[model samples]
Target: MAKYKTLIFILEGSLLNEKVAEQNALRQTLKLTGREYGPTERIQYKSLQEKTKLLGFDERIKLTLQEFFKNDWISAKGAFDNQLQKQDQLNKDVLPFLDEVKNKVNLILLTKEKKDVASYRMQNTELINYFSAVYFKDDFACKFPNKKVLTTILQQQNLTPATCLVIGTNLVDEIQGAENANLDSLWLAPKKVKMPISPRPTLHLNKLSDLLFYLELS
Candidate 1:
């Protein structure tokens, strides 16, 4: 039998190359404003985004754009959104990994993205067919790292925390959320970054394909 009855995946960085998408979006936004940004600016922008993550998506985008541009921030935000949609792509390992375990456990996508954006990205990547269900930010009515969202998902899916595994790339959101909910979590750290002592995930993987070995052993 499979170790977990359900595998809840974080859609953005887990399945999709969100870093690439975000970088591309930022580049497009800069182009729209006729501005040039280097690694330093990108790092600062990312830090700012992290600090403002609690805000709604639109608000966060607006605030981030305002920090860099004096005017036409709305147009920059629109350009970023449009470019993000076009730039979002599935990780190379996503297809092969999912194919190996899709039949073993129920696949659920839990995303902080709004329904429309999440749906568009999933459909664009041809990932919509693989997941049994998708829970959008709209469904939860709150940002991530909230235990309530996980508990709500468990109740709706008729699952216990022990029977489910949360997989995500973001430590603060996905791993911490699972920890708060008392669920097992697998951290997909592509760069093999050292995990912190607090809010540690149950498992740490260097790549998405490693999950197949874990599932087999479990």
Candidate 2:
């Protein structure tokens, strides 16, 4: 008998396309605001969206209305969250890898999103079926960087500490969480910046495709 080889891939960050969309939006906001307002923050966009909703300017005039009211962090965060929710589905490029490695990999979405919201988004993206298990924030009553949360998941699934991997964008959270759980960790650093401090990952990957290579060579 062989021990179960569980290769879990954790997904984070809103769709890459949405990030581009955000940049375009920020440029538009600068033009509308008549002055570039620092870096575009999600919280600001979300708050603006919320204010737009409360004002009831109608969708047709929302942009003009936003220009008049000025942008704020809360409004931006609200807008960003709303848009992000729609785009927060599974990544397309990752599908090919998941399909190729289905036999060996057990993809799990360990996210901070609540179960209902995360499930709906995953289902909409048509990516829910690929995962062996789904872990949500409510399931643990705690977020990443919490060792007890990962430990509980492993304990429930009877997983060996050494056979698991936690992958995510935020270095401190995902890498630290995996380390605290006593599991192998993969840090996806797209920006290619050196980690600020200690608690480094078992592996550093610049792209999702790199994960396949790392697993193959490791």
Top candidate when judged by TM-score against the true structure? 1
Clashing pairs in 1: none
State model 2's lDDT. 0.59
Say which candidate scores most in lDDT.
Answer: 1
How many residue pairs of model 2 clash at the backbone? 19
Whole-model lDDT values for every prediction: 0.79, 0.59
1-218, model 1: which lDDT tens digit per residue? Answer: 34777899999888888767777788878877777778878888888866874444456667877877658777677788888876668888998887777777889988887788878777756677788888998997666678998999898988877779999877777788899999999988745467768679988888888777666532
TM-score of each: 0.81, 0.68
Cα displacement (Å) at residue 151, model 2: 0.6
Model 2, span 1-218: residue lDDT tens: 12325755554542223334344445454455465645454456566654442121123135533443455644554554444444443445667766766656566667656777566556646456667887877888677677887899888888877767776655556677778888877766554466545577777776666666545422
Please report, as a residue range, the 10-residue window in candidate 2 with the lowest summed lDDT. 52-61
